[model samples]
Target: MIVHTAEVVRYVTAPAVTFEPLRDGASRGLLDHYLATLAVATGPVGLTRMIASTADMTARLLDFAPDALRRIGADAIIADSAEPSGPIIAQHLGVPYVISVTGLPLLEEENVPPPFVGWRYRSDRLGRFRNRGGYRVSHFLMRPIASTLHRRRLTWGIKDADQPLAYVAQCPRILDYDRQNLPPNFHYGSPWRNSPAPLLDPPNGDKPLIFCSLGSLQGARKKLFAIMAKACAEIGARAVIGHGGGLTPEEEASLPGNPLVRAFWPQETLLRLCSAAVLHGGFNTVLDALAAKVPIVAVPIAFEQPGTAARLAHFRVARVISPQRLSVATLVKALEEVVHDPTYRDMASRLSVAMEAGGGASGAAVIVDAALSKLP
Candidate 1:
């Protein structure tokens, strides 16, 4: 996204788990493992895993940072919010740190549903109560890791440190959400890449095209793809399945008709040509489809996917199918509904305009620069 910019620190490797230079569907397993674990998004086990993963990731990055510091004589640290350790590291170095988030900025708010629950946004008292309880549970799960981080901070020469967002009050937050949707504090910048992405050849077919993938994490669902392929066929649609290493060679060979199974494909290129999409409800994929003005059939299998699907469903841009009820018939029905209805596409188009105005990655850079300029 900083392709047009003159000053982006190109770090090929920062986190121990990195995804590939994505073409279409390569499965970088470590990246997928981190993401897939969060697919659950809620629950005691899920929260514990997320805490552990982020803490480990933070430590790894810290080990890598001294080299980065020496190489650049670094000025400031900007971190993805999920990691939470970035700000602390910067604190140890006596440098300002900014947080960048690629999702809703509300975090755990009483008025909104806790993320990934697929609950509608409501101001009702009951909704607030539900959110409060959920947030408390998550905080409880975080205590162990929080305590560990607390000790780590002392070792890092940060004698007094708070949790990640505590720094945000004093730093800029470049958020990947719309101004209309986000609270006032976050600077809304779209996560979609502003630079033009190269395209791939569309699947060869006269039928309405459907793009399908579960993304990298939680993508090893061969059964889901099989159902999607079958449903696409039943609906007289052609699906190009960017399996992301999800399907077997035999499974790919046995796909009924016009279902193109590949390791991956240029997703943006396909989205531009697709009539519909069947996706795992990953936030990035959803934003990509929205930017392309494609309607979606969101089957949320894990993590914040259900919440992402809920947001789309709330916008009337998608039809959400819970995994428990996923079937060829239901999937087919959703495809037909979206492809035939102009409303879904129109809603998606509207979101595209709003998100496009959100300044994408370049906008994010501008925010980061502004944050640095004010640093004392």
Candidate 2:
């Protein structure tokens, strides 16, 4: 059974999956504000606001989720990394839970920067110092969430050690920086997605195809989509844009290259035919593009996107551009490099092989089952 927000019901199409929506009045509005904050957040200030909003949402969840889960009689909980209330609620219900990191994992190491930063992995003394500083800032921003969790734990008589039974991330270990301190229960799993159905009629065009997406949250940035469309046109490629229902009909009609614009699409199907991709550096999209052996031009906007883009650059599979510096000219240059160079595609192919070996959702399910088996 899935305990989610009411808005999530539309996406829950699996026949066997049952869901219960948290009856919190403030959850939707708070979540909207959080996403809005992430769309334009640049540094510490924006991150603080995001954390504050999350704390507010967590409080709401704490007020209602325990009762909801009790009513449903959930034996075990699988929680998204973004939801901090999950572990606390699981403890309140005395149920084993798993942490599902659908995006970049937030684990901190001295040699690796926090997930919010775009800094590359560095192991040298100065690099470690920089990473430590970044983590300090991250901790500072997360204080609100920490305080909320602490208060709730105290109220519910839960321990400070709110550890999950298993911590599974969709990020392939090969794509992440070396980590010597991962928890024993942590597993690097592949992207969680169903097999793609064959496209009834694949796109037919002489021009090299480029897939562009900003993901669901930031897909409403019409100006950014315009730049992507213009850049693709300048490079003599066809751009297929998926805005995730974030665009209006009139706005979609104005994009350059006479691009095909849609609210959603079969991403994997289209990506298999593309030479390169333009993205907001969302982890899932990056994984999908790599799985399809497509190189990327990443314009990271907020959240863990910059960190994901940094990893892509580290692997030489993508060119990372800051959203602040994004423009038709800059995007065109990045696209040209990724499209014309074979090295990017080659590296992506290598990672694709590694991801296949990492065992996708099935591998994660194995870890989860093992964890739950040990529970009393």
Candidate 3:
């Protein structure tokens, strides 16, 4: 497994798995700054800043990954969709590669809005025009990474070919907006997990339990946690917060409602016990929540979060409150509505069933095997 030095500590690899750390890359500080920038940025400007922040990291991956992968004699590559360099490196190395959509799939379709924006899915001519315009803007913003890839491809004497052997997303088709232009090789898969997570005992008390998580990347927002806690408290719900090591002990203690705030927890286990979830629209957590048949209240902060939240709303499984507009009262209203309404729970349950039918990691593996089988 190849990953950044900072992320190496997060994984618990099996005996057969070896982690190859990419060193001297983006520092923790730079990554934090990038996340911070995205917290306040929105629209096309936010997208531009996001691409600009990752320019150096993209260059480093292009410089290091091809040689490292070649040395390892890797026969096939499974590249994260978020990392564009992966497909390029595989092309340069002449290896078959599969693109894994860990977050929202970045595939461009005229009827689908770009993943960064919260625009609703539209199939009309005007909507298609708008969607195309969004892609053009995204393509323009991506020139920095594109330039790096072009230079590397030239140096390696490889022609431009970014298409993957297969594409699998960590989302079920029902959770996403309808897409008419997906590649034939594209497959909708389930969230990757080793096994079915065992359900945990619900927290003691009759107060409706609500799981609140901002995921690892955006968990550091103390104010957001505080707002969620306050809203849950007002709604007479117990807020179980997993901030992913983002909060200091003092900060955690300072949150309202004396909410059960931990740096980490068995999220799937907690979701099973919760009546509703308050999320930052992180895809993995959203999947976990839906899998538990729990309704949601989404506060989208950055990246493809808004788009994810929009889908949740489109399906009537969640209520979205943009971070810029989020507050204790707004969250309280969303939380109460989701918890008390049977429709939200019903929709979530339906999606959960659909998600299971699509199959999880095992289904994704089958697609990968088939793709590789087609390779020479």
Candidate 4:
């Protein structure tokens, strides 16, 4: 039987890991949930970067003891296939590794340019231009640093791990990026299709409905939650929100007593029902919105998020707002434009058709099967 396993390899510490840090029980719980899914399909194995225990020890062992990987009996190692920790371990195990690009591919060497540069590169012409230059420089310097950290903590030796054979991106083919340069084996795995059914029935109201979310990871911040709340208030449209990682209990409790606000609306359901959305421009949210044919207003926070927001603006599928300038007025204006303007909705709907045509579960399954084929 072919054994399949996932390891965490990228952004396990600085950003992705920090949100819930698998080291902390919160992140670990999420990891466990996904691992359980994989376990049902393939079998479970430990995913590290859990709470950021000095991965140094784990790396050293994998670098030296190829047998450790063998002991796991995994035929293929999928990195970020579950989380971002697998590819590093797979690299040292001298086994085949597949990098999973669940979010917009942000790493340059990986050829996955940050999603939505069309917007990010233009937000503030001068400031963004300078920031882009700095980001490039920073990325150059940090590649090795990131690589070193991966080597030291995930493998027996940094020098021993081989770069992965392919990556499975979560984006749909409609949002096909220009930067992913890996082998043809690199694949895109869409989670929207993989997700459960829409959380609620499409809104039946005649007035335009607006849905708001910050994706799942960054939904915990009170300030951002407040911004979303205020935006919904100003729009005066029917609204649904999935707090994701953005709201506090108190904040949720305090939501204005308007039918417009909800703490946990199924995003896909709401997107399908809403006339427009105001979101953080996360890859998942953007793709899901596009698939649902809903126009968007993106307020990006960090990393590839800004780029993703920028792309929606460039495509005219959504309005892109800088986090610094995302005032209630701007949101109200953008919301009105998307809701009232036929052009925006038309563009979004056409893109939604394209996104729908781009296969989802089948694509991921194809990749998974191919990875298995390479195994002994």
Candidate 5:
């Protein structure tokens, strides 16, 4: 299977950095961004139109590629989400394709709305209930129509009928993923997060270190930063925050203290030397901390975070404090608990061992390659 992956990419600075849009306000024109980025990858031209979902966009793709489709031939395309147009093109080209759900809820589950909805908007019991209805609607109505369109057009002369699989989840078996009555073909690949950056070995620098970040989606708000600054100061921990979300000039200038506060740090790299992490509880951050064997003081901003926090509590690995109801006192206390309490550290250590047991990238790569091998 020659796989083609369709996912969103954004460069707040330059040169185009590709990241999952699991956070809020990260991508304004997602479809446009994906269509542009997809062309950058090597693939067939006619199929690229199907990937872009624009017959016109195919022309632009074709101009760059003289007889690209004829040269590449038919290969399997694995789309990360229904959001991407690869399936549409795959159908038109009669080529095999797969859908890869990058996040938890988007993974092969019945009756769950997009997790991105949670970060962008408020969710409740009623909202969740409504999502169930909407899930049913899309699963029954929209999915079939789109799937039919894809199959009819592109898959006409496709050699392998069963080559294109349904859902490929990027979940590690080490984590507590809900694996119920999933089909044999419904696969869980290795975590892409396993490509952890090389640890910088930040010299442990003499103070109790706390890794702090509100997440890239939720940028550095002065109020939140101020509160965190005060809390970290009280707790006597050096703070390091990431600037992935693109802070403004004033925001950059206004960060509390220089020697103690860092503007940016590689997440996995920092996790190794830090005593504790104070993050907005994005799934990636949470999983990275678990992989690094570090305790977390999760201040969930929205959506799956609350559920993620609940899951952490269930796992007995970390503590959850809602940013909405959280105070400097509560933040300070949570930090103290994670930093001082042996239990939190022990649980984190245990979970970390479990996470590492999967063997990171190599482990995940095996599952993905197996699925692809079965395709043709």
Candidate 6:
């Protein structure tokens, strides 16, 4: 419930901006540039932009605190894990806060491998050494964001308390909202539950149902979705595509029809009917596919997607095809392999069981109760 209450855009903003569109109104090559280097290459421009964005959003959120308190009168704050805003705002308002993470538990433990580094979880000395230094260096690069948050706090006349890590580490409760075919042992967090999706009647019988979408921001990639539509058509599967991006008449017209393309679709409800999915590997989409026992053809574009794609492939429930290498032929081939192979489905089902056992929403309630009881 600790969500950004931005009207209309609440569903879009989170841990970070999706590589869906350009920030400066420059559209054509923004995604291309991001996919080329933003995956692993963090540079001055990227870091500066990241810091500026987070700082600006945090201030905006803080601006709303007074109104939010008057309207909701909530006792505590539940913050998204992407930015330090939650903790900062909670501290400013004198309330206890718990973070709800939707991605891998990278910062939860020192031995847990960093996601951006693209390392597998290994307990060996070499792995631990790498993880330790890797986390430190990663956080070092994040110093600018931290500095910005501090400066904003001072501007608001609040005393600084070195609250970033203290806020994260001292969070008596952390809720990981997803399980994406990973080892159950590494799955930390109080589980949040999902309702069983209402199944849809497939338009075509016996054809593999492939649900395709790039999610919130990237859904605007008309070209990529068009390619996916063609691939699905080539393979003769009934594809239902959700265009999360608000494509106008002209842009939507170019999308292929063999795959049903719509401005939007109820993704959770739709996944119930899918045999396989072609996705940009967003966190929610991955978890939904795992829950539905659907194998994935992961085409990671940016953010934590590449890391998620690596893990999914390592788990054998997915085949990774980087956007740079994405072609109709390659996309069709990967989907073919995943659809025909029983192994991916079996593994995906196993993950689904683990995910349910982890106690989705109910587990989160228990943690929140404990956190509250600990207070005074």
**Top-TM-score candidate index:** 2
Query: lDDT score, residue 287, model 6?
Result: 82
Show where candidate 4 strays beyond 4 Å: 1-71, 81-85, 107-136, 140-147, 150-163, 176-182, 188-192, 198-206, 245-250, 257-263, 374-376
lDDT of 1: 0.69
Tens digit per residue, CA lDDT, model 2, 1-376: 8776566677689898888887876445645666677665656687677677778778878898887898898888998888888988888887888999998878778988888788978899999999989988778778888899899989989877678998999989889898889898889988888888676777777988899999998889999899999889899988999998889999999998878799987998889999899999988898999999999999988888889999999989999999789999999999989888889989999999998898788889998999999977
Q: How far is candidate 6 from the true structure (C-alpha RMSD, Å)?
A: 7.4
TM-score for each prediction? 0.81, 0.94, 0.92, 0.70, 0.66, 0.75
Between candidates 1 and 4, which one is better according to TM-score? 1
**Could you give the candidate ranking by lDDT, starting with the highest?**
2, 3, 1, 6, 4, 5
Q: Candidate 5 — which pairs collide?
A: 50-89, 91-150, 91-154, 92-153, 92-154, 93-154, 94-154, 94-155, 190-364
How many angstroms is residue 365 displaced in model 6 relative to the true structure, after the best TM-score fit?
A: 1.7
Which residue pairs in candidate 3 collide? none
Candidate 1 RMSD to the correct structure: 6.5
* Cα lDDT of model 3 by residue, 45-76, tens digit: 87677677677677877877666676667899
Worst 10 residues of 6 by lDDT: 165-174
Alpha-carbon RMSD of each model? 6.5, 1.9, 2.5, 8.8, 9.1, 7.4
Supply the TM-score for candidate 5. 0.66
Over 4 Å off, model 1:
1-51, 62-71, 156-185
lDDT of 2 at 167: 96
Q: Stretches of candidate 2 above 4 Å error?
A: 25-48
Candidate 6 lDDT over 182-257, as tens digits, reads 3232325422434554546545577767998887666767788888988988898877888775466777777784
RMSD of 4: 8.8
**Scored by Cα lDDT, where does model 2 land?**
0.86
TM-score of model number 6: 0.75
